[model samples]
Target: MLSHHIQINDHPFHYLGWGDRNDPVILMLHGFPEYSGAWAEVAEDLSRDHHCVAPDQRGYGQSWAPEDVNAYRTGKLVGDMVALIEHLGSRPVMVFGHDWGAAVAYALAISRPDLVSHLIIANGVHPAPFQRALAAGGAQTAASQYIHWLRREGSEEQLAEDDFAKLSSLFGASMDMGWMTPERRAAYLEEWRRPGRMRGMVNWYRASPLRLGQPGEVITDLPEMPTHTLRVRMPHLLIWGERDTALLPEATEGLEDYCDNLTRVTIPNADHWILHQESHRVAAEVRTWLKRL
Candidate 1:
């Protein structure tokens, strides 16, 4: 894997790149606390046919972390993607994201459709369903309780002071017990220990409620953009883990209402961390979908 850094609005963004520059670009965004390395195995296969660019979104890995909570908002996060894509001189690239990264990808597609041609979302529900689920007060709320904890002041100190072992263990336990190798866990611990990085990661949840409270934003409406106004102009593939404990399956029940051209696949026996637990299957499906497109 090749590593590099780019500047977007004065903030340094760290990413991994593979394949030829002339090939079609597929930008991958990883979720909270995960760096671009999470896509290493998948990118290796995809790079054979496409340009794969996986960025460690702001506040994670080697990326810059701003102190302001607003920096972690979806709007700014999507703007960073726009800048990154433009920096690469690629427009309408295929974009794939998991977890919080998926939410950012959805916002990017909706807020700036011209920058994304296709979207592959794994283990995350649409923003509208997510909002409704949060309000309804059930499993979604229960699953998200950790977010509130993270948003509290001094939480990062507590987690970091513990050497990030607890946080690493939480991810491993919640996803796949054996998903994180010692080396990978050590890398995560090192990154989280960076100055202000842990706090920046937590700011994602802190700024989330602001986005959710936006007025005149219809979470249920099909994305409001020229390409998606009438129909989903870009092909969309949704891969979900049937055994996901973080995001309820019911959140995806009415997804078809938002996408005109949607293909849904469920991975049985997989949990929230589908990419880690079933990388080959996920990669194969992504490759097949890209070929069809």
Candidate 2:
């Protein structure tokens, strides 16, 4: 494995890498409250056949984190990745994103299809459908109430209080966290301890364009997103952890309509942290799916 620190879009960026230059590259994007090391296990396995690069995106880990919520906007977040991929030979590579990472991945694929040959998402939702689900005020709306609280002012302070008791609970909420061992938790603590990191992390939620309503409050006025901007034109893979409570399956109910070539898989007994809980199965699924290409 290798550690990288370079200037991307005028800010210092950090990423972890596995395998050598000769291997095909698989760019990994991790979600909220997690860092590039979140891909350590799966990347280690995939390194046997591919070079895996997982970056500590804009606000997390050692990456440049602007406290400005605008920095977390979809275009800025996607632009940061565009710069990274350009730095990595400017070739279309397999892009895998989880949770918040999926937001950027989807935007990259949509705005610059030439940069992504394949799109993979684990326990994440597309903005259009996710917005619709939230507007409907259904199960997903109820499941996503945390977003509202996260968008509130000083929520980061609350998360940082009591030794991050609130943030820790958020991590373990409605999900199985047994996969989080002591060392792993300690690493998370260390990263979260970084100055302004917590605020930057929650900025992702605050900067979100998707609107939410109180439980059962149907919102019909959320503006529609341009269809051309949300379509996934490349071969796509959708992996779901069936037990994920934060994003119910209904959130992705119509994902097929947005992709021409799509494949889906579900890992039982796994939750939002599927990457950690079922890294083996996720890697195997990725390997088997790629074989079909």
Candidate 3:
């Protein structure tokens, strides 16, 4: 893999690139507390036919981490992606996002449709459903209690004091055992040990109150761009792990309301960390979709 840093405004974002530069681009965004390396297996496959770029989105790995909470907001995160794409010569790129990265991908497709050609969302739902669930005050709220804890003052300090053992353990516990293998777990631990990385990862939750609370006017309406409209209009694919604890099946209850061209798949006995647990299957599915696209 080829690695480099691209300056997005004031912050320098670290990214890993694979495949030929002349090939069509696919930008992969990883989730919170995880670095760009999470896309290792997937990118290796996709890079054969596409220029795959996986970035340590803002707060993880070698990416720039701004101390201000607002810097981690969804809007700003999406903006950083738009800037990165522009920096890469302003071509329309397909987007693949997992977990929090999926959320950012959704926002990017909606907010800047011209920049994204297609979207592949994994293990996460649209923000509207997430906000409603959080506000409804039941299992959804209970499932998301960790976000509340992360947003609390000094929460980062506490996690830091333990040398991020708790954070690593949390990832291991939340994911399927098969997914968090010794090698995968070690990779995550190595990234977490980087200076100020934990705080930056936690900041994603801290800065997303607007979407996490309620759908504001900005996102309430369908995106004006052709790619941002309802499900039937955009070319899309959704891969879900049925055993996901944080995002229950109910969270996807009304997803069809937005997607135009959509295909949904459920992996049996898998959890939130589907990319790791079923990396080959995920890569095959993505490869098939790209061929169709």
Candidate 4:
């Protein structure tokens, strides 16, 4: 793998690249509290046949982290990827995003389907079903209490306190931590400790328009999703970890309403961090899925 920094939209963006430039492109996107290294293992496994690029993504790792919360909005986030793709060349690319990155990927595909060849969503949600589940007032609503806390001002300070004690705790909050070794932990800590990075990461939650519902209460007057022009027409694959407590299975229900060609896969034992917990298995499944496409 090689590391490089390029200016996109007049901002310095850092990314890890694997394989030759002539190969098929797969732009991997990491979620919250994770940098490009989150895709290290998976990128390595696929680099032999594909050109894999995973960027720090604005607020995490070595990328540019604008202090303004507005910089992390969905449209801007999607624009970054669009600019990255244009910078790479005018070729259609496959996109694989986890967690928050998945949300951005969905938006990118929806906003400009011509740029994305295939959409791969791992343990993430589409806006419609996700918004419904978030406001459903049950276990899902209860599971998402942390969202409110992370959205508060000075929340980054709280996460950065005591050497990121709260941030570290998040990895094991709803999933196993066996995949995160000491070396990996150190790398993640290094990324989190970067000046201004924590605030930028949390800004994603604050800028999001999605809201969580109260448990056992009726949720009304929620903003309606776009009935037209919000559909994902490209072939899409959703690999879900059934054991994920953070984003429960219900969050993905009715997702077909927004996707035209959607294929769903369930990993019974893996949790939210399935990319690491079952690297080879996930990689193999992705390979097979791509072959069928």
Q: Which candidate tops lDDT?
A: 2
Global lDDT of each model?
0.79, 0.92, 0.78, 0.90
| Cα lDDT tens digits for candidate 4, 141-215 | 989889989999999999999999998897689688899899999999999989999999999998999888667
- Show where candidate 4 strays beyond 4 Å: none
Q: How many pairs of residues in model 2 come into backbone collision? A: 0
* TM-score for candidate 3, residues paired by index: 0.88
Can you list the residue pairs that collide in candidate 4?
A: none
Which pairs, if any, clash in model 3?
230-258, 231-258, 231-259, 231-260, 232-259, 232-260, 233-260
Q: How much does each candidate deviate from the true structure in C-alpha RMSD?
A: 4.2, 1.0, 4.3, 1.0
Cα distance off (Å), candidate 3, residue 88: 1.9
Worst 10 residues of 1 by lDDT: 210-219
Better of 1 and 3 by lDDT: 1
Candidate 2: tens digits of C-alpha lDDT, residues 106-147 = 889998999899999999989988899999988999999999
Off by over 4 Å in 2: none
Q: How do all the candidates rank in terms of TM-score, highest first? A: 2, 4, 1, 3
TM-score of 2: 0.98
lDDT for predicted candidate 1 compared with the true structure: 0.79
The true-versus-predicted C-alpha distance at residue 77 of model 3, in Å, is 0.6
